[model samples]
Target: MARVVVDVMLKPEILDPQGQAVQRALPRLGFEGIADVRQGKRFELDLEGPADEAALARIREIAGTFLANTVIEDFVVRVEEPAEAASADNNAEEGAVR
Candidate 1:
């Protein structure tokens, strides 16, 4: 099955309190050298078929209408390679080295 990934993130002008909180906590938790953090949401949709142009268009509409607040957030929708294909590519790279 194909997969559609929707990434929703606040606009650069908007303040992200949740992200700030995490950033602050990270320092307290002994993590350092991080100057900034912006949190976002990711939605994974497993499709029964390929994510063609029409399907991508529909997903964009859905993302703009319901998933992201266009006024304050921006969203991106993309197709993801199947897990098997990705692993196969990785395996090929590994084999090529040896």
Candidate 2:
């Protein structure tokens, strides 16, 4: 399986109340070095197969249309690479299943 990661974040012009609240509380928590904070969402999707060019295009369309609000948010989509040992193990398991 392949993993698709989507990161959605509010546009700079938009007011992020949740993020602002966290930022305001940071100083009280003794995290004074931080200048600012912007909260975002991450979605990980496990696809049944490899993400080819067509699949990537479809994922991009999905991100733009469903994962993010174009008016006040932006989304980024990318294929996630498995860690080295995990990738090898997954490949080995697939070979055994075949």
Which whole-number lDDT from 0 to 100 does residue 6 have in model 1? Answer: 97
Looking at model 2, report the run of 10 residues with the lowest lDDT sum. 89-98
lDDT of 2 by residue, 1-98 (tens): 88889999999999999899999999998888877789999988888879888888988899899988889999888887676424555445544422
Best model number under TM-score:
1
Enumerate residue pairs that collide in model 1: none
Candidate 1 overall lDDT versus native: 0.89
Backbone clash pairs in model 1 (N, Cα, C under 3 Å; residues 3+ apart or in different chains), count: 0
Kindly give the stretch of ten consecutive residues in candidate 1 with the minimal lDDT sum.
89-98
> Model 2 has how many clashing residue pairs?
0
Query: How much lDDT does candidate 2 score?
Result: 0.84
Clashes of each: 0, 0
Q: What is the C-alpha RMSD of each candidate to the true structure, in Å?
A: 5.7, 7.8
Candidate 2 regions exceeding 4 Å error are: 84-98
After superposition, which runs of candidate 1 have C-alpha atoms over 4 Å from their true positions? 83-98
